[model samples]
Target: MRPDYPLKTDRLVLRPFEEHDLDDLHAYRSDPEVCRYLYTHCATLEDSADRLTKTLTMSELTEEGQWLVLAAYLPEAGRVIGDVVLKWISEKHRQGEIGYVFNPEFQGRGLAREAAEEMLRIGFEDMKLHRIEAQCDPRNEPSWGLMERLGMRREAHFRQNEVFKGEWGDLYIYAMLDEEYARAS
Candidate 1:
């Protein structure tokens, strides 16, 4: 089994989801700007709490397909400004998917990328994963750009992967192998 792990970057700490992060979860998940790309649409405080509880429950039990979500806290501001995750783990492939969300208020600060880089390190080096992939709606340019900036290549474009808000949406898949990450770093 792949073990849960924590990673740290210069200005961010990538760690498991905590019960105390309810406020941060509510703030961003509820924002339309933030949830535009998320599978589940914008959530309310109650909804975020319900989802957080479910995630925490699965994490506590070490469920195989569950994600380990990390809150991006800015110490100087004394707030959680964003989150990153390593999810959809497959033991057979030794691989997983990575995703992140930043508070609209924190969008320009570079905190999300800082947090994601640390999670990528854990997924590649500590977990010994063969591949890490990220999928985003093609129209979400910011997220797609982030995948490229993180050294992952755009590997596939699945046309009309799903219908989002009544419109057909295409998904762009970006991926990196452990060897590729090591070479680029």
Candidate 2:
């Protein structure tokens, strides 16, 4: 589904990534700490530019395997602080997934949660999804903590699931169903 642009929360704007967001996208994506748990390593400016170019095409989700990625823009800061993503994983099963990454400068402010919650809303309310889930490295406390705060129950913990950063890594999966979302709302 193509979301109405500029999905607004109390303190941030969730919109599609743009050509102009390169610098801001690089700001956080270039940080080693931010990229530690992510699949990609710290990105160079050119890398961020390449990523932004691809992100430009991910603004809408019209079919399975597509991703809808939005920029988490803080107007007062006059820049994009992070991004939120929803993947249309399975249309027949009505399943989707949510994910996010924000500048450390913007952490501890609930902005990531605010942006991610909107993705959940779009998944369950707008897209009529049956289930939505999020997965993160088990050691990423802040990420899992935010999932708990959003009322997503811990669904699984896979030990040494894959090679990450050249070592085995554990994964934590959290999820919420449409009925669960209705109750939480």
Candidate 3:
């Protein structure tokens, strides 16, 4: 399903990535600290451009494996501060996943939470999904904390589940069901 563009939140506009967003996208993505817990490393301008191209086509989630990515644009700042994503994981099971990343400059202000909550709303309400999950490195306290704040329950903590950044890494999974979402809402 495609979201109505420019999904409006209290203080931000979540929209599809545009050509002009390259500089802003690169600004934070190039920071090593911002990319620390993420799968991707600090991005160069070229890397950011390539990633931006991919995100441009991710506005629609019509099938399993597709991702719906939205730029989290802060109006007062007049630029994209980060992005939120929802992945269509399983069609039959109606399962999805939510994720977000914000510039360090905007980190503690609850902007990521605001954007991620919108993705959960889209997954449970608009996509009509049975469950939505989020996974993160166990050491990424802010990420797991955000998931908890969103009302998702900790579902699992897999020890040394995968090789990450050249080392074995633990993963923490958090999930929420549609019924859970309904009750919480």
Model 3 Cα lDDT, one tens digit per residue, 32-55: 888999999999999999999999
The parts of candidate 1 lying over 4 Å away from their true place are: 1-6, 57-63
| Sequence-dependent TM-score of model 1 | 0.89
Query: Which ten-residue region of model 3 has the weakest summed lDDT?
Result: 1-10
- For residues 10-88, write the lDDT of model 1, one tens digit per residue: 7766555679889987988899988887788789888999977876643321444877666777777767778777875
TM-score rank order: 2, 3, 1
Off by over 4 Å in 2: none
Reference-based lDDT, each prediction: 0.79, 0.95, 0.94
Report how far residue 1 has shifted in candidate 1, in Å: 7.2
lDDT of 3: 0.94
Candidate numbers, best lDDT first, in rank order = 2, 3, 1
Candidate 2, which ten residues in sequence have the lowest lDDT sum? 1-10
Ranking 1 against 2 by lDDT, winner:
2
Measured by TM-score, the strongest candidate is: 2
Q: List the residue pairs that clash in candidate 3.
A: none
- Alpha carbon lDDT of residue 50, candidate 3? 99
